[model samples]
Target: MSDSSINLDELRQRIDQLDGDILRLISERAACAQKVAHVKLAHDKDAVFYRPEREAQVLRRIMSLNEGPLDSEEMARLFREIMSACLALEQPIKVAYLGPEGTFTQQAALKHFGESAISLPMAAIDEVFREVEAGAVNYGVVPVENSTEGVVNHTLDTFMDSSIHICGEVVLRIHHHLLISDTTRRDKISRIYSHPQSFGQCRKWLDAHYPHAERVPVSSNAEAAKLVKTEWHSAAIAGDMAAKLYGLERVADKIEDRPDNSTRFLIIGSHQVPMAGEDKTSIVVAMRNQPGALHDLLEPFHRHKIDLTRIETRPSRTGVWNYVFFIDFKGHVDEPRVAAVLDEVRLRASELRVLGSYPQGVL
Candidate 1:
């Protein structure tokens, strides 16, 4: 046999041995996870099987300890799947996301919970909240903001009426592609379908290429992809999952105007997550319609040196001219400074609600 062939055969044999070791280790981890479930159940009848903070800490540690040809994120993702699978053996988790099956929110849900999770698709953001609130699902995933399009106001508005708490968050880099079905006539395409935000994201690209094509706004990019499956003269602007789900081909990839386009999704549940070293807190503040009300509300955070991540204003459902400010900031509420800041803000504001203090997104 050739030396190269012998070397390749030996490498293959080594890989086979490593695979066996990996499988055995994974099995042992699964058994350990099962034992953990038994212990928790023995201690408390209604013990929560999932811990967002714990999972976040594990993934973060995996990322920090990783030193490999594969990047930290890639390594962490592998560990995430393993953890997810082991957790399923302990107790399967059901999650709901804003969807009709194939949307960015669904992708975010899978990314956060892993494929082992049972994911249900709800037609609206509020429905996702309802499912989680009703105990029909363990958690829910909904879009909070887009890098290009700003906040999803519907999501924010839904939060104002709901009692759901944020457990964790996941950020997905969005890459919209111009996709078509097998029957689509690329040259003869006269109509395009997409969510309004998607059209806005790919506006420049569409204007430069298919200016005359009628831009039809739909409920979601998934719906747009579904529509293109039957229309030969139509194309859809959507992400990879939708295209793959609908069996559509990408005519133009990554057509979003900005290369750095991304969206942040929130994981909502009933329980408050514990701190995982790095954390973020979300609160809604309703200030009386008066001069310097905003200033009064923000002064405490400034004084405490708390890093504010985002601040969004929505018209309050209460009295006229009243507004509610959705604020996101660094630090968990359990911390002294953060608690003090909240106490000060509460004194200045007409109404304030700390939605949640959760671990910042690790992946």
Candidate 2:
């Protein structure tokens, strides 16, 4: 046999052996998870099997211990699926995301929970929150902010009234593509359809290229992609998921004006997550109308040397004179310094609510 043929045969044999080892190890892990479920049931029938803090720790440890040709994130993502499958064996869970099945929110949900999870599509952001609150789903994923377009006000507003906690977070890098189905006429494209947020994200590109095309704002990019599938003279601006779902060709890829346009999504659940080394806490503070109310609310954070990631102001719904400030910081609420800061802020504000402290997005 040729030396090259011998090398190829040896390499394929090694890979097959490795695959067999991986399969056995994964089966052992799933069996252990099933035993854990039985133990929890014996201890308490209502015990929650899905623990976000534990999942975060496992992923972080995998990333830290990885010494591979594959990058850290890529390696972590592979383990994510394994953990997801094991968790399903422990107890299968359902997650809800903003709808039509092809949106970026759905991608985020799948990214966080893995493919083994049952992900349902909700019609709106509020509905995602409602499903979680109503116990119809185990968790919900909703967009909180975008790098290009800023915060999602509807999502922020929904948090103001809901009792649900942010158990985790997932950040998805967005790439908008100009899509056309087989029926679409590339030369005669006259109308462009997309969600208003997507249109805003791709405003510069649209203005420069399709200046004359009638722009229609639909409920979602997925819906727009669906619409263009049946129209011969129309095109849609959406992501790869939508294109793949609707079987559309990408005429223009990465049409977003910014190369790094991304959105941060929050995982909403009923339980508060325990500390997982790296964490972020979100809170809403309602302040009475006064000259130094804002300053007073922020001073505690500055004094405690807590790193504030983001702060957004929303008009209070209860009273015109009151202003609500949504604050995100880089520590868990259980920490001493974070607790001190919250106490001081509570004394200074009319009302305070700690949304949740969850592990920072690892994968």
In the range 235-339, model 1's lDDT, one tens digit per residue, is 999999998899999999999999999999999999998889999999999987889998999998898899999999999988777889999999999999999
**Candidates in order: C-alpha RMSD to true structure:** 0.9, 1.0
Candidate 1 lowest-lDDT run of ten:
314-323
lDDT of 2 by residue, 236-349 (tens): 999989999989999999999999999999999999899999999999999878889988999888888999999999999998666799999999999999999998888888
What is the C-alpha local distance difference test score of each model?
Answer: 0.94, 0.93
Cα deviation of 286 in candidate 2 (Å)?
0.7
Residue 341 in model 2: lDDT = 91
Which segments of candidate 1 are over 4 A away from where they belong? none
Candidate 1 has an lDDT of 0.94
Provide the clash count, candidate 2.
0
For model 1 the TM-score comes to 0.98
lDDT of model 1, residue 234 = 97
Clash counts for all predictions: 0, 0
